[model samples]
Target chain A: MKKIGVLVGVCLSALLLASCGTSGSTSSSGSKAKGSYQTTGTANSGEYKGIITNGRYRTSKSRGVGVSQNTENMLNLKSFESGLTTISKDHFSPKSYVFQEGQILSKGTVENWLGRKSKDNPEGLNPKDNGKKDANKRNPIYVQQIEEQDYMKEENGKLHLAGITIGIGMNRKDYYQKEEYGATYTTDIPKEQMIAEGKKAAAKVLARLRSYNAVGSSMPIVIAMYQQAPNDSLVGGTFYATTVSNSGTQMGTWKATDLKNYVFPVTDTDTVPSKNDADSFDNFKNKIQNFFPNLAGVTAQAQYDGDSLQGLNVTITTQFYSETEITSFTQYVAKAAQTYLPSGIKVDIQIQGSDGSVQSFVARDNGDKGFYTHVFSSY
Target chain B: MKKIGVLVGVCLSALLLASCGTSGSTSSSGSKAKGSYQTTGTANSGEYKGIITNGRYRTSKSRGVGVSQNTENMLNLKSFESGLTTISKDHFSPKSYVFQEGQILSKGTVENWLGRKSKDNPEGLNPKDNGKKDANKRNPIYVQQIEEQDYMKEENGKLHLAGITIGIGMNRKDYYQKEEYGATYTTDIPKEQMIAEGKKAAAKVLARLRSYNAVGSSMPIVIAMYQQAPNDSLVGGTFYATTVSNSGTQMGTWKATDLKNYVFPVTDTDTVPSKNDADSFDNFKNKIQNFFPNLAGVTAQAQYDGDSLQGLNVTITTQFYSETEITSFTQYVAKAAQTYLPSGIKVDIQIQGSDGSVQSFVARDNGDKGFYTHVFSSY
Candidate 1:
């Protein structure tokens, strides 16, 4: 009986050790089980599971870690190559979330892969967590930001190729038309559908634009703009990229130099979001992340590297408003050109007031870096 | 003696008949043993021999004699598939043309295509010469009438997939400063070379544009513009096209209501034997034929057809002024457009004065019941 008891104890200890080894390394093949999303609305709902390899980092919170994680944990950063973990369109473009994985990831055993880590150990594993609570677990804060600048140098900067657009609006048209005092005609699709189409269109346009290299310094690209109304009458809005030029043949401003430059209230009116309504910054970031995760890095603390260019101009526009009631609006559209924006370039921003007055802001200093100069009075 | 004389006469008659038969049917091959071209600026050159599976036509005096030709003459009408003959640049895109042996070209040959006539005969070899003659052995006026129409359609209407920009300029430093001093910089390349490049760029751009379908009735297109000198410089022009739009919250000119109300130029430009440079036009046309010989018709009445289109807008700009002097200048840019433009479409010509004032003329009707409107002088 004594001998039997000793054998049983030894077997239990060995099993425990094996289980612990499985959850320690992220780069191990099948090391992290795939993750799934259970979503509502336009989002997809299902459980996902996958393994990470080649320098992938993972967090138990970002994806459901398998019950098999050991004392140390690994994270999945495999999205850099094989693409990213995408959620169906439950959220609109420009969305954000504090991602969490419900459990430890399960990576299948690869003795050879794990054997290359440390002096005392052969298995390559992520360093152990500094004895902190596992709530934040392996999840790292991913900062994402986006900006609009010039057209030519934007592609090389971020090294990212964007081919997706996500947005949300009223999926219903009756309510939207009613709220807007009966506006009609535009897209052939219904309001909600149109909004969805618009969102998809934007994504498609960007994807295609990224495929080619066009740098016409002659004209500032002009386009049409749209906005969504809240509720069943709408889903999202749609717009087009178009242009009209002056006789002199140079684009003086984004609004166009051939014509007097000014920002005016949107000719058409639509519903205003209630402040009580959920603030949607998180949702926006979430959707955008689906297509362009790196955009969150737009928040850069840039310093002026003193320089002069033989022939160069830097132009960017940003709009920030935190207002509850949007009685009126006007949209200024330009292609996102930050991907290749030169590092040391002068920037000019035109900030407009509700009354159509304009203020030109030139920022060669770090202090002036931020979103567009135009903001609503209430915001 | 009488018997001998009779026998001799009989033999002579027999010999004479035999000689006549030999002269009539010559079943053997002629001296067109091979084909060769002087190596020069013709980017592409070749030799091919095709049969008239159907009745075809030839306009070039050098082509379309009998079926046994083995030289350059036998290669006309593009009867054969691959031996020789320069194909258009369009054949190099994602999609290309596939021709079988014995197929006839509509304009370059005697008949439409082998067997494509009212009668169905794939091997029909009957042809026409029209017997019309000019100093160049082909009617220049007739060719102008036909090719100009085709040039407008394929060159301007098709949707563009993608393209590259040939030239880029951030600012007008050289020409602008010099225009102030009334100095016009002549191009090192002769007028013939400039015209040739312009034509080449046009064909290439057109070929690339044909691969895509219109986007939401907004066909993606590239513009191959001849950026004319501001009466101050002679520089080769550039071409640019777009398959993608800049990522902005706007739509481009497709949204402009002006499309519905817009009218075409009213009159056509005049074309006379240009005084400033008499040989320039013939040389220009010859340069084009060398590259695309099929563009010339068998009757020498060459006409061009837009590859495929419902309606397209074309604006042509040409000058009849010498590089050194501006006298005897007649605007022939939009001349053919007025007489040949189809219905429901607009094509035009614009003339610029020494001081930069402009006048416009509309395309003429194709003589069909359908007529295009000319809104000349409206601008």
Candidate 2:
């Protein structure tokens, strides 16, 4: 009996070992987990559970009532708005404002209503106080404008903006047009200003969670910033920035995989002025234009390795009367280009004749008075 | 005891099977046979089973006479001559002749002696009766000449020959000066005539070899004919033709792996007269001298892919007083080259001025009335 017990024990141990090894090896290489939320209570029960969605926090109980799909959607919307408000306040400051998609009490909505007058509503709503009971029944998420802030502007008869973006929950429908989201001013503001505004707006986005007792169930929220095109007819804007709130334990694991930093324009006020090699090459070409009276024009292309000028190739079209003239012209052009081009910039000059003759010269600058030159000709 | 015997038998069978498998697998991958010659008889014995030295047959018998180093050397010399004579007769024919080295009895030797003689021996030795017995004592393999064939000639004071080469056994020292063996006639003789003369001389060489029976053994022989240089001082001649004799069974297998054939001069008598493209280009340049008065010279290089003319590159160095003149000159040259060059030949023309400017044109023949022209220039 003792021997049998020992044998049985060994067999059981082996089976356990085998099972453990198999499970450990298969998990990582197997299927991924589905669904973002963890259910804590029975469906539709008054019992509540805290849920984080899109980085924002909410609860399953809707105002102390049973959880419903509609209440879940509303909580999701509020969570999204809470995340946006955090972003706007923390980052954008004076340059940006946060808004809910359906909140009718927002200043921007009231202004919009006052501005658009129709035949049926000849008396436009007052900007200060529209005083309508129906307003409370309106969607709870709506555009909000900060004090003394105008979200839209016109300049030079063209509409422009810093940028705008909008995102809907994975399970909900988008209620607004793509253009109604993130936007910038219409004026030709400096790139530096625009980039500053964009960065400020990005910083205001909160990577946190918020739960309103007025709403039900925990909800997840994701906020994305879309960049607006200077001209809508040109190209549709793209999502440029993103942040999440109410992710709870998944907060550390949830990665904002795609984000782009705004670029500023180079202005005279900047610390360093831009130097273009192509512009310099064009200037050099102009200097040599008069040297060949018979030449029609001179064109040049400059090559660069990063910001350092590597080489310049120039071509001129002209007519040659004799071999002597061709030689003289080639020498003259070579000398002129050598003198006109910047030091250490290698230049190649090619001249083509109307009668189908070509002469080419390469002048390499060694940072000295004279240039090392090589000439090639096609006869 | 029976059980033990059965176990032992089984073990023995397994061992046998393993050994057989190993042996069968190893034989194919084993080392290869070494050395070039097959060993027949015991070494250093007067009784030799046939041995092949340098691809030639030899036996242990040393002529049955006392072995002397001088006799051996003479035999070796004789064998070499036999090879040459065979080659001359079998290949060169009436166009060639063979003369034993230092053998004044041979017509070609006597003539050479006479030709080199000054005021004292100007009459030269008689071809049949040059009684100077010392001539025979001279190295028997001294120098052989094929006759009626002045292998070398002076043309306009320049020594010239067609070209020729000869390679002897690996270990033997070359007895004759390189120039003495292969020669070309100075005069412009038809290739066919020279070949005929060489053949005849070769036949005579064979006849002379049969007279020397002192060697008392048949020998394998290889003969090589080297073409002579047009001007011996200008360039060394190259190998031209070859033949063999007394090679026996080995003749078919013994290939002249290094033999090079003579390139017959292209002459007017041939079915297809040779046209020197360089000369043609020079002639064309001369014809267009008047068109570019300021030009120094027009040089051209022609390229051929095998026998097919491919292209010509021409360069003209000159001076041009005005652009108009340059254009006209370029156009004139392009048109002239297009008309002068052979059909399907592409021509590139470049004109360079004294002052260093250059004009180039490419005219490709399209098998039409005009050429497809392109112009390149440097101004």
Candidate 3:
């Protein structure tokens, strides 16, 4: 009995040592297991168990020892409001916040008790909550400071922004500090949800601008939502959605007036349509090839409004076997272009000789059921 | 004595097993030990212990069982000549080789026995050796073949080759084939040595091209040598040397006539001078700043011919504190530009108001000296 007891004790000691080794390995590896967000109700409820503090929401679980406390212990609504006030004092002008479409909030309105401190009182105690209040008498609009950046694409000396990205948090370093937030990080939100939120925010901003009558009505705007992550940088971010809106005109600043023009250079290789409109232009060129068997090669330049075809300029080089056939070839191409091309597109055709001389013709849509008519042609 | 003998036998068996295991490990690991090149004489002699065959030299030592045999066994001069002939037949036109200054070689010079089979007779068996030579009687110029490709740099819609690249040997796949020559890859050649060889080759080619009177005298040509590597591709290569040569006109075609033009748009940010001639333009801008204390910002568009400054267009935006100060400021800037700028460089200055109206002035070189004379002033 004594020997058996001694063996059992030795086995138990070894098991304890193994358990301790496993726990030590976990901490030394620095691999923090990611925590999953749990929905309180429906899967797509968009609400999680967290409290919004310091411009971001924090969950209730403790990340690890010496890292972070539970959310309930650290969160303070009054302190958060005070921090916001301090930030606003440093970065924004007094009365900068717009309320009720076009009215600027008076100084000290945000500091007063009227601004809701928690979700319990979404709207502060105001007589105007009855929905009959005048636009001038509403509470100040409160937001967690908006950050905007232009996303530009430049080609051939033309610079334009496709959209504007708006971030909803402070700079990356401040948001990513492990001492403050522990292992907490932002994740990607659904695009449609972000778009809906961006639209709501943009509507308020536009209404305020309209009340002040500051900007032109025809100006275009793009509101994109960026969920701030720990790794966000100045030039890039995790974007959720981009929504384009116009103030008054349907064709706003983003709409380019005409397609960009290009000129194809002469080369020894067989010429083809530019890659920008290869499908439609190649089909047209092939049809013309069926008409003129003496054609050696074809080169084309085109203009487009976005991706839609606007106009085409084509040059055809021939073997120059027969001078008499040149007139018939030009006529045939002009007719073929008129027959094949879509309505409202302008076509310019040029037949190039072996010696580099070019004969030019222009084909235009007649607006008579997609039939094309030729303008003056020079041979 | 019997026990001792048995012990010795057991130890020998263990030793044999260990040796076999080591050999198995070497083969299984696929570890190839690199071998050093054997020099024939002094390090700089450019000769190695190898045999020249198939247009490439090969070493004597075997690379490994599955790798390749040494260079001596794989190299064959006749096979190399045949390969060249085959490549020429497929890719080159008849009479493509240039023999004498401007003379194209007739069809079968490469295959004829009179042509030198080795480097000992570089020009082959000439009639001069027999003392019956005539300049007119010599066969038309012949070369194995000459190939040319453009090395292009594309920017801002303009595509140009600063130099022309000439490659020796067949394409990459043919050169790198393991079946033809085991372990005979191009990586063994050092980059600097290849560059030196390419420079020498380019100089010879340029001299030969200059001897030919067929091309325009003023044409500028860049001859860059490319040592064909086993991994040669369209987008990238291991370049050796690039040398520029001018034809009869010393000025050469490479000298661009006009400064590349640029346009700068007004923006809220402070504008700097364009990258072309930034130093001189910035100096002139600083001097103008000394004259105008209320200047808000300055944006400049300038033109340059290579590194030389040609013309400058500057737009200055300033606070409209006083109308009288504006005229004096314009005069000061115009005078400063004339004094600071180099002769023959045109300077156009424009002062813009907050509302976008501009006052213009033109500063021209007087030509008598460095003095700049203002042609016109508009407010």
Candidate 4:
């Protein structure tokens, strides 16, 4: 847990002052006060059925948005930064998380599930405590939205349904492989207890939504977010079976589920391709994996919402690959997506650049997600 | 499309008779008619979950005579001897699918969604068809069981439902790196014709399960598989949904929903261990990528399922350095797994030997469903 050389913050004099003191252990002041703050998300479009988008259970030639089943109906993110100074008693935010860059974060999830409370009294002058209703439990559902540079409780809102909301930060770890000395979130909470907390989060989000009268009388929804699994087994990412809030907030980010792989809709092309070339597939997988250094491979899982009679806003986002060799590969996979995917499935692939710039393409019979810049390396 | 070599079938005298006094092109029908096969697997005693005893999904913590996820699931296979044939179909009854080697498969899933024909040619099969009930369209989920040197059908059986069921599989293809050949799957059934066929299939599986409804009510199951996607957006994996079956038999198998990633359960313990006194998570990811001759790193964007639960079931599967590594990293990965993963989650690590043999470890909490043996690579 000892971070080595993080000088991103600290002025020269501050650094010297700290080192000059006896014992040399710096106190947690001077640096920007950081705190874990969460925000919710809502989709700008309609919902579809879950299995329908899966490649195997197609009833129509619909386009698929790459949303995992485990993700709840809405998208939720909570910042894991450590320094926090309240804008007011009811408001607080962080400059950044306390962990190191590229340091696989496991505790963020445990923290997300278990929302923070002031540890002192329930609810008094510290609006952060929210009247001490449930101080000890974590929902594991973190929804982050960093839209406004300044967030005021009355005007600068915290949740947005659509319209590219920003400010949220997320980190993904690996799935198939584990890192030595890597940290992961582990909880002693029992399964039944976790389930109970999941249910409560769902209810809390629902209540928050209803209070805003944002309930559009639509079918229930689910919220989902994908982060790297520190390892495999317990689960990665967070899934909440939920509905959207009219206030543009993710209503309920719940507990994890065990539905990573399910038999549902599969693509028509599952039949070994004309070439049936394993070499090709490996090449493609590697190509994409290169960009998303933490990712293992690109798997086309399906998403479906039970809202009937409407067009869906489907989005398929990809992770960053490691090298240029894979950059082309990942882009190729994203581009080839236009061919193998169903017609109705409006496909778009995006890669978060090293500097966090997003490169994307939306594939269709007409519009392209901009997958090809024409660079091939298949030797 | 040119095949490397053909397996001749006719006797030299017969071949001469057929060729008469012609040139050099010769053809044989024997080799193709009955290629060879092999036999190898593990089994446990008693019943565990919906799986058979000591079935594939079993770990030392519990003996999971669980349903067999696949007659074959350990990946990285590479042996092509002869004489391999199905000894029996549904060897343990319940209609079909019961087998000694397959333990991860869910019995309830098999009973309810596999290998059954509809009693009433149920009219109005939903989305009308091109209207012909082609037996080829009868793609029922089928399982070929191995019996005493013969293949037989296990009719009239049952299913179990203890809690939840999970199915796992591994895939390798160079598609992600290959852009021109990328593909995907879709769930849109635009014609409305396949819907009727799908309904028919569903009805048969439903009926069969009703017949064996005494069990399987309490179980929630998930079947999982991995597919390598092209690095490009427009290509690789399937874009359309598909159901697997050939006429009449009605084997209830269906494909998986396509998503950007297929999140598998795993743990932080899945990290690649440091050897020779070295340690760090980033280093671990690098090592994993190096292990796979074609894999890059781990998968990203996973969604967890359990909210209030204590320990989640995460089984980190593979580790490699990159997509183009030799086997050294894989061996090191396997060794690291033994040291890192606990007795529970069950580690099934594979290492390819110089002599065309595969060394593997099916480490469970305690049970033989876990194995330490050698086999040929098939994946």
The 0-to-1 C-alpha lDDT of every candidate, in the order given, reads: 0.22, 0.34, 0.34, 0.25
**Predictions in order: chain A TM-score:** 0.19, 0.26, 0.27, 0.29
**TM-score evaluated only on chain B, model 1:** 0.19
Residue B312, model 1, lDDT = 28
* lDDT per residue (tens digit) for residues B192-271 in model 4: 33334433444443333334343233322222222323233221221112232222324336553432212222245532
RMSD per model, one decimal: 39.3, 38.1, 34.7, 29.9
Badly placed stretches (over 4 Å) of model 3 are: A1-195, A208-306, A309-379, B1-282, B285-379
lDDT of model 3, residue B299: 60
As for TM-score, the candidate ahead, 2 or 4, is 4
Model 3, residue B339: distance off in Å is 11
Ten consecutive residues with minimal summed lDDT in candidate 3 chain A?
A39-48
lDDT tens digits, residues B291-352, model 1?
21123210011111222112222322332111100111111122122222332332222223
lDDT of 4 at A203: 46
Candidate 1: list runs displaced more than 4 Å.
Answer: A1-379, B1-368, B372-379
Fraction of the real A/B interface contacts present in each candidate? 0.00, 0.01, 0.00, 0.00
| Candidate 4 lDDT score relative to the true structure | 0.25
CAPRI tier for the interface of model 2: incorrect
The DockQ of predicted model 1 stands at 0.00
Candidate 1 chain B lDDT trough over 10 residues, lowest sum: B143-152
Ten contiguous residues with the weakest lDDT in model 2 chain A: A143-152
Global CA lDDT of candidate 3, please? 0.34
In candidate 1, what are the lDDT values of residues A207-319, reduced to their tens digit? 33233343222222222223322222111121211122221233223221110011111113422221111112122122222221112211111111112221111222222
